[model samples]
Structures are given as structure tokens and as C-alpha cells.
Target chain A: MGGLTVMQALAAKLPGERFLYLGDTARLPYGTKSADTVRRYALQAAHALTDHGVKLVVIACNTASVGLPYLQEALAPMPVIGVIEPGAAAALAVAPNGPIGVIATEGTVKGGAYVRAIHAHSTAPVVQQACPLFVPMAEEGLTDGPIAEAVAHRYLDPLMARLPKPKVLVLGCTHYPALKGVITRVVGPEVTLVDSAAITANAVERLLDEKGLRATEKPGEHHFYCTDAPDRFARVGEIFFGNPIDPGAVEQVDLQ
Target chain B: MGGLTVMQALAAKLPGERFLYLGDTARLPYGTKSADTVRRYALQAAHALTDHGVKLVVIACNTASVGLPYLQEALAPMPVIGVIEPGAAAALAVAPNGPIGVIATEGTVKGGAYVRAIHAHSTAPVVQQACPLFVPMAEEGLTDGPIAEAVAHRYLDPLMARLPKPKVLVLGCTHYPALKGVITRVVGPEVTLVDSAAITANAVERLLDEKGLRATEKPGEHHFYCTDAPDRFARVGEIFFGNPIDPGAVEQVDLQ
Candidate 1:
């Protein structure tokens, strides 16, 4: 539901930093497609972001993180960070022991990036589920109703029923954090919800500080761009960011 | 559910003709997107199809029909058919007068192609409703269940309650034919459901025959191509086509 998860994280954590956010609404929800297509779309989106001459970029989307290397290569010397690593690290820290359950978009789950990343940190049996409908449900703003609960139960029931019960449920898709209440209720009180947005925000802060690329501007202004459907971005942007984005500030650009 | 609606219609109608079908499984369901994005994608898809040396191109999708002129211009002298004209023609034929109901994707409905086409034929009030979830529902194979009925009732109830009730309800999206049973029940026996697939197939037949492009050969071969994720196409493709498609036979092509 909240497509601007990482952007919100960085914007909130780094008040002095200016951002040129680009949403590839044209080929969005890249969570369900093949690896090759996601990689291609990610590169195109990264190119659009860098075209604005921003000093730093964040692949706020977990699915698009697969093409981080390509983006870094293309925009060398300019810093770029992806959400997956930060998310995995956060999940491991949250649950030092026991099984970890990860719910993400179809592509991220199918890509097994989270599973592999989690394995590197801990020996817990990481269960990954692709809740494709969660994105649509989140976009519709049905965060805690019967429909959202039913959908949550549909995806979380099996993960909770594993032999080694998962103590930490990583909300891999950014939109998922909106359904946190419903997800938490379904998974019960014993499970901790790890949001990638907060984790990535912390990572962005650390990376910027360590690299000596910190900015000192106060109340930084942000501009938004989209590959297609700027109107949709302006309309739905409020759901992601609590504040309404000015329609005039959100412009459409050709990513091709 | 009937992803191959138009193609299935053509396959059934013209058994002796060779067909090469390309499903843009990567960036699909163009019904909710902006006109510019849809036009660009349609052009890319059409160009991919023509690369295979096909004699004619058919835009079975109502949403992509807007890009027909662009496709025609790009591949001049090659025959092309869009589902909109055929669907509108079929509806007018079934209901020579009065209000005509059209249900399709958001892009197709908002594009107002049906309204213009219907007005060109009859002075009847054209009622167009955008059923954005129908495509997802159809793809999920929830065609005739309670969920499908509920969705159908939700969309068709308003159209059915019109002053001059719609006599013929055009199933604008290709995938909509699968939901016909539910739509028919909701609209009652008084209303006729016009399927774009059948109409477009007949139009294709007429166009081919008039141009003397009919083949006398027996057992025509069919080829399938996808821009990305052939596995998804082959899986959901079974609902569209009554038979299962061999994944090996389905080739992946780069549209870019």
C-alpha cells in the first residue's frame, strides 16, 4: 500500500537531505515478474533518479534491489543503497534465535534474496511467503478490516504453523507495514514485526555518516517524478507519506 | 480468465491459418494505466509481434486498442484489427436502439473509446463502467464462484438500474468472457452479453477473406512468445485456453 516506504524512512531520518524521488508507475509492482525484467526496470528507474543530478539514491523497493550493482556501476562515485541488506540485518538482530518468516512481493520471495540474506546471518529456518494480494490490499487502504485480516490469515497461517515457529516476521514489501496491525494480530503477540523502512533509514544514516557525505540543509525540500501516471502518484502518495504531495511537484518523465 | 479470448476466437474460426500470439506477461493489464504509457507499450508489443514476420496483427485487448493507429502507422500496409470497433459493432447489432452498457478495464473505460464508437452507430446512451478488479479476478480463476458473483453484482448493479436499462452489456476486456455466466445472471435474461473475442474474430475473418488472405492448408500451426515470465503465461494461460501450453514451446523475447 505504501510504495514510498524507503523514501519516507530516509526523508524522516535525514531532515537536512534533499531527495529527487522517482516512482516507475509505468511498470510498477515489479514483485511478480521474472528476474530479468525486474533488473531491466530497476536500471531504467535508477537512470531516471540519477538524471536529476542527486548526490545519493536509494532503491527503496526490495524487488528492485536485485539491480543495485548495475545502478551503482552506472552511477559510480554517487552513493546508492538498497533495502534488502538492511532489512535482513534488522530481522537477524530482532530475532537472535528461532525461525524467521519473511513476507514480500512475488519477485523477492521467488528470487530467494531474503532467504539467502537471512541464512548468512543466522541458522534459523527462514520461511518466505509471497503475498501478492497484500500490495493491492494495501493500495486500496484496507489496512485492518475483515478483508485485510482474511488476507493476512490466508498468507500468515501457514508460516505460523511451521515446525520451528517463526519469532520474527519480516515485512519485506514496503506496502506491508501498513497492514502491520492485522499481520501482528494474525501472527500473535509472540512474533515481532521487522519493518524494512526503519532499518533502511538507519542504514542510510550510517552509510552517509561513514562516507562523509552528510548534508547540512534545514527542512529539505523534496521533488517527485514518475515514469507514468503522475496523477496516481499524487493521489496515492499521501497514503505512503502522511503529508499530501503537491500535484504540481509530481511530474511525469520518460524512463525509456 | 480468458486471456486468450481473441486469439481463441480466431483459432476456432480460422483453423487453417497460422497464428503467432505474443502475451506481454511482463507489463500486462494495461487497462488502468495512462494513455501515453499504454500507447508506448502497445507499440513495443506490436513491434515485437511483427518481428516474427506475421502477416497481420490483432490487438485483442480493449485497453491497447487506442494504440491501433500508432501500430498501423509503424507497420504500414500490414492489416491490423482492434477489439473496440468489433465490440461496439456487435453491441449495436444486438441492441439496435436504447442504452448500451460497456464494462471494461479502467484505461479502456476512461479512454471513452466505446462511447465514441457506440455513438457513431446509434444515438443510444452509452453507459461505461470501469471494472478494474475483473482482470485480476479473471487471472486468479475466480470466474463463477461466490466471489465472482459478488464482484459482478457490485459492478453490474448500477448499470442494471439505469433509467433506460442496458439491453446489451459489452464484456469489454478479453478476459471478461469467463465472468459472463455471473454477469448474465446479475443483468438477467433481458440483457445480452457481447463478447469482444467472437466479434473481433469474425471481423478478422471478414478482413482476411476480403483481402484474399485465406489459407487452404490443413492443420495450421500456432506460435507463442512472451516478453517476460513465460512460466506465468503458461500457467494462467490454461484458464484462457482450455488446453495447457508447453512451456518449452513458449519462447521469451525482449521487447526493448
Candidate 2:
């Protein structure tokens, strides 16, 4: 999913902040990368966002958030928030007693970011499944149909096979939020799906409010920039943002 | 998949030709954008490939290949080959008499690349469905499980429900080749599956040999680059090209 969608969702949830999103569409899905590499990319992205004069930079990409320390260090003065911590906190808040499940890309799952965050707060046995395909499925807009269901099952069966299934599941990647319906069905009515994006959005709102840096009046200008083609980002940005977003304003930027 | 994977695969099929692949993993999966946008991205990618000093540039992404004329115009002087034409040719060769089904990202299906290519050579009716999620699934390495199957069915049901069961199905995207098993099951035993990568590999071999541009002796360096984090591409590259693959060679590139 693109950053615009996350920003849009965050804007709707908080309603007081001016957001400028730069989706690294040219170089997307940091999910498969190493922590060091993700950190570097996140740092670059953070610099871009801060340069746009955003009050606070939100590391919307879960991969980047999982490796947030580097990003935090990279953006020394600007406040940055990631989805992992907030989502972990939210999951721990409501699910103190249940088995917590986390599904994300192989890299995110391998990073043990959610597991670490969850373990810090609760004693629930965290079950993790690398639902790598969920991102592409969501990006392709395969939310609820038969194909989506099949893909969901393909990734879910192994996790479900383990005894004492997880009662609380973390949709670790931002892209996975789009697959909530199919994921919910596959896990059955027993599981509580926690979307990290929603939690992250809430965290952004809270951070902005606490810092007293909310953008109040004007409908802020959103200049979409991607390392890749702006045109491609615009088309897919609509799907990612959960709306029909136009790419007319997007300007392609080189992130060297 | 990396050009390294393509080179390795084609090395056996084509024999003794030097292969250079520019995956554009930094700006991957050109399947969700508009025709013009895809063409532009393809041109940029082609220029990168051309700059590598290769005799030909393969628009490996099916989505970009569908916008061939525009790409052709954009990357003039350099002989360009797209996956769509070769894949279509292979599908027709196998099922000249029966209906052919194509599953790809929205852009590919919408562009009618496969349909147009196949129709040019054979009388067989072509059935197309936009399986946009398949790429993410494959990239994430979730091809074997219930999730993969579910996603496949989600895309297939609508297409299968309407069209006659195809004797051949084209795996238009490089990522889709990894999903051959899941797709085969969904499409059934009767349908033949054609992978665009395989066709492109063979085509590249043929073209290089015909032009005396095949590498002479030593294996060429397969330097991978991405606009995003190279580590993610490297990890996924392991799934595609096998483990023990070196990501140290994945350089960070700016594609603006």
C-alpha cells in the first residue's frame, strides 16, 4: 500500500494534522529487506518527509517501523512514530489473556518485531506466520473474492494447524489491512484482527496532539512523490489509499 | 525474480550467451498503473538495461510489455523484447486449437497484451482475468498453502465461472511462474500453463545468439540494483534464485 492511504486514514482518524506522504513506489515493499537496509531507506524517506515540513514523521511502512531505532536515530530532532509499538500496545491492551498471532511478510516475521513488542507487554504465546502474499493480494485489490479467500487459506492453514489457535492476530503489515475480511473469515469468528495501520494512525494523532503541532485550518497541500514513476504511483495510490485518488499533483522525485 | 535467475535459467536453454537483467525491483510490478504511466516506467527501465551495454532489453514485467508500442518508441535504437509477445507465442504453440486463459495484474489484462498477441497468431479465443494479487503472493513466497490457493480461486472463480475451461493458461508475470502449482490445481489438469519468464528466457537466448551478442566464456556479473532497499529484493531474490544468493551486490540506485 502507498503512504497516501495511510496518511489519509490517519488524517480521518485525527483530523487536525497536515500530512505530506512520499510513497517509495519506485522502491516499494521493504518487507523482504534486511534491517540495516530498511533502516537506510527509512532514513532517506524520513528526511524527505521532514523536508516537506511535516510536524512529525510517521514511519508508515511496517518494515521500516520494525527497524525504527535506526530511523529514529537518523531523524534526530523530528519526532517519528512507527506502527509496531502502538499496535503492540493496542493488542496487549485488549488481549492480555489470549494467544496472539502475528502475520506479515517473511522479513517482518523474521525480524521478530511484533513478537518482541508483544512479549514486552504480555505473556501470551505469540504465534507468527509469514503471510507474504497478503501484500500483493491487497495491493491488487483482492480483498474478499474467491481468489482472495484461496490465497488467505494458503497462508493461514499452517498457522491454524497449530493447536490452541491465536485469539488475537496482528495484521503486521500495512498492506494486510486490506485483506482483513478474507483473513477474518479464514481465522473464523474466534480471532480478533488487529490492524497495525489503524493503531499507528491513532498513535500519530496522539503524538501530534501531545506535541501541540496539529495543523488546524487550511486543507493542506499533499505533494505526492515517489522514487518510481509518479504515474504508476498515482494509479495504485487510489487502491492503496482506499479511495479513487488522482495523480495529477504527484511529482516524481529522485531519492539518491 | 532477478536477472541472475533469468540468466541462470536461460544459460541452460540458450547455452553460452551472456545475460544481463535489470529487474527494477526498486520500481517493481508495473501492473497497476495506466498505459501511459507503464510506458514511461518501461522506458526508464529499458534505458537502464541499455546503459548496461546489452544488445537487447527485455521489458520483463508483463504490465510494461503490454504497452509495447509506447515502450518501443521510448527505447528506440535498443532492440526491446517484452514478455507478453513471447508468452503469447508459447501459449499458442501449445494450444492452437483450444481456448487460452490469462491471469495477470489489472494493467496487463486491461492492456489486452496477451489477447492481442495470441489473436494475431491463432484463432483460439483468449480469456483474461486480472489477478493483481498474485505477484505479491509469489514475491512473498506463499505459493504452496491455502492462502495462495484461496487467492488463486478468488481471481479464477470469476473468470472460470464465465469462460469455457481453457486448455492453456498464461502465467503472464514473472512472479506468477512461482505459483504454477497452485494455479495448475485451480485451473485443473486439462489446462496448459505457460510462463512468460520461460518464454522470455528462450527468446532472449535466440535473439542474443542470432545477433552474436551471447557472452563468450566467463559468467557475467549479475549486479542487482533497486531504488528502494536492496535487502528486501535480495531476500526475495533468495526465494526466486535460491538461498546463499549475495545481496552485497544489490546496489542502491536512484531512478528519477
Candidate 3:
């Protein structure tokens, strides 16, 4: 579902580029599953996208971004961009010297993809917390309220309380953007919030320019695909997509 | 997984019954998925369980229970027991007269399984509320807190305030039991809370007894199987299982 947010960002940035977005709604919340399982699913998803004649693949999901190397290798000759690198770069650009905070799903935090990406550029003191409840809260439309606030406080207060308190906080999970209001309130105004969607979109544009694969057309059409529940995906997906999704337009594909 | 809760209740009620519990961790939270997708997944899971030489199949999940008829037909001759019927029956047993409040995931509530099941027995008015956040709250160990209370109040308060004022509140989803404390506080003491796990367990016992399939052994061994992340399942499953899950004992199997 968060991938919808990334797709929205990419559409906004590269208006000429046609987008074929795949939401594996059936085996979703990859953050809770194992790395091997996620990798296998990611490969399947990549293959689905490739089969559709997609020019480049964007691993919009933070958990799936951990398998960037595998996806890149498997989808070789076809460019693959993951959210972690762009998010890490954006966070470092904002706060290169000192502390950075990252909040994502358990799998992403445990995989340490953001941590590794951040370290690759600059050695910043990173404090990572896994706010597992945020996904459900975001999906349930509890993005703002007492429940959201309390949950945010519980997850963020600890990270913010650390020594040399984080100068920049990276919203590692795509769903985090939906809860941006509550997250912003909890993290306060001083800390910079890094959203991977916009940065990843920018990265995609740069990649297109470098590879000379940029579409020459003016405006491009967007097609949505999901492994299951195309109707529900189109309905609930509006939250992350930031646009109205025509239920009839969404196609159901079987990756298996 | 909520199925683990059903497994726990079954273990407690029928000590002599050998149990084979399968947690579809890879493609979980069937509540949010489409009916067709859930049915397909449920069939796959049922096939996996039947392949293990299990005598009977229990669709412990509330969402999956919507496909009980389909499963029963597919796995014919192998008796299938779904949680919805037993839970609805138990709710009716306590309050045979008027209103019943059913709280479950979106899929279950949308499917109207509990309502149909209850109406099948009596003319009781059923109000169903979908508490999408409870599953994550339970899994995240925020079962009893201000956050939990707020979420419960947000979900239950409306259902409780409806005309006729439900005399009984049914915890349709297995995960709801973990938040029983908060739910009790919200719904008040007058409303009797009905948990599907225990009721379903009793149904299983009665079915075994009637069919002469009850084991003669004194104590039965419990084997846990999951589609993915055996280690994480073992670690986090304690909240639902109410017992320490041995990581080494939990085998990972491929249902596909």
C-alpha cells in the first residue's frame, strides 16, 4: 500500500513516464515476515513488473528494499532502485554531522538497511526504533487522535530522549507519511523529517536521465495491479496514493 | 496468530487430542483481504493440514471462517469446524433474547458470518464493528493501556450505544482476547463477553466425542507449524498461545 505513495511521488516527478504499479496485497506487511520469504516475494513481484515491460523497478517498500542486491541481480540489465539509499542520502544531506533517527517496521529496523545506507555515506549516530503499530493505525485512518498520539509518543519519545537527540528523523516506512501529522507533532519542529517517496522519485528521474530511458511523451497513464483484492486495494489505496483510484481500472494479477 | 489462540483453547479443553497447528504467517491478516483470496488461501492451508494426516480441520480464524462452507465441501469426509458457528451459538446461549455486539476484523464483519450464524439460531439483533487496529495492538503487546483503551473505546463505544444496547459482546477475532481487559472496561460489566476460541474448542471436543475420534492417550503432543518466520512466530506467539513456544519445535512448512 505504501508503494502507492512511492508511485504517486514518481508520477508527480516524471509526468511523462508511464507507471505500472504492483501491490502484493495478498502477502503484504512484509515487515513481519522473514528475509527469505520477503526476498522470494520481491523477486516474484519484480518478475511481474518486468513481464509488463516496465522500464525500471522501484522497490517502494522499505522491508523489500533490504533485498535490493538480490532484486538488482535477478533483474539485471533492468535498472532497480530501492527506497533505502535515497532515504539515507536525504537524511544525511539534512544532518551530516551528528545524530539521525529512523523509525520503520521491525523487519526493516532489524535488517539495518537504512543504518548501513547511512553509514556508507557518513558515520552518524543513528537510533532506530520499530513502530509496528503505525501501519495498522495508518490503514485504519487513526492517523491523528489520542490513540495515534499516544502510540507515537511511546515509539518516538524513547528515540528522542537519547543523548545528542536526533537532528533528523527518517520516515523509513512508506505508511509513515500518512501519519506524518502525528509523527511531526511527536518528533517536534526542530528535527527534519525525511520522506523516501519524494527522494526515491527524484532518484528515479535521475536514473532515467542517465540511462536515456526517459519517456518522450507529455502525460503518462498509470495502471495498478495487485495479487489479490483489487477492489479493496483501490478503495484503501487512496490514502497512500493521494488520488482517486477507479476500481474498474485496477487489475488483479497472479504472481505465482 | 489468532489461530494459535484457538489452538491453545483446544489444547486446554482436550488434553488427549494430538494437535497440529498451522500459522499462515507469510500471508496473514486475512481479515483485510477479499473473500475469494481468503477462501483460496484457506483451501491451501486446509490442504497443507490435511496432507499432514490430520483427522479434522479447524478454521480457527474469524476471517477464514467465512469460507467454512467452501472448505467443508473441498475437504469432504474430513470434518471441518469453523469458529463462527460455535462463537455465535455461545453468544446466543448466554443472551437468547435480544441484542448481541460482534467485534471482529473488517473482512469478518463485512462477510456477516457471525450475524448470519446468530440469526440462524434466533432472531437476535446483531451489531458488528470492525476493530482493525486491535490485531496490531495485540501483536505489539499494547493490549492493556491508555492507547488500547482509546482504540477499544473508538471501536466499541458506537456499537455499544446502538439501539437495544447489546447484552452480549462477542470477541469474534482470536486476537481480541488479548485486549479483554480494555474491552471489558469499555463494554461494562453488564455485557457478557464471549470468546470464540474457548467455544470453538468445546465444539471440537463435542464433535470428536460424537464421531468417536477422541484420542485414548492421556496427554497429546502439540506440534506448531508456520508458513514463514518460525523464530518470530515462536517468540511473539506467546501472547496468543499463553505458553512458551519452543523455537526449535516450530517447523516452517511451504503451503504453496
- Model number with the top DockQ: 3
State fnat for each of the candidate structures: 0.37, 0.51, 0.88
Lowest summed lDDT window (length 10), candidate 2 chain A = A1-10
- Tell me the whole-model lDDT of each prediction, alpha carbons only: 0.82, 0.72, 0.91
- Tens digits of per-residue lDDT, candidate 2, B1-256, equal 6344454566566655455555665445566666765676667766776777766776667777766777677767667777888888888888886588888877788888888888888888888888766666566566777666766776787766655668788887667777889888987887788876667888877787787777777466556666556666667677766545477777766556
What's the ranking of the predictions by DockQ, best on top? 3, 1, 2
Q: On residues A42-149, what C-alpha lDDT tens digit does candidate 2 reach at each position?
A: 777778877776667787877778657776776776787888898788778767865777888776888999888888877788888887666765665657877667
Between 2 and 3, whose DockQ is larger?
A: 3
Give me the chain B TM-score of candidate 1: 0.96
Candidate 3 segments whose C-alpha is farther than 4 A from its true place = A218-220, B218-220
C-alpha DockQ of every model: 0.46, 0.34, 0.86
lDDT of 3 by residue, B32-145 (tens): 888999999999989988998999999999999989999999999999999999989899998897699999999999999998999988998888899999898888898887
List runs of model 2 lying over 4 Å from the truth.
Answer: A2-9, A95-99, A118-125, A145-167, A181-192, A215-256, B2-9, B33-60, B64-79, B90-100, B115-126, B139-168, B181-193, B197-209, B212-256
- Tell me, by TM-score, which candidate is best: 3
Q: List the residue pairs that clash in candidate 3.
A: none
> Between prediction 2 and prediction 3, which has the larger lDDT?
3
Weakest ten-residue segment in model 1 chain B by summed lDDT = B142-151
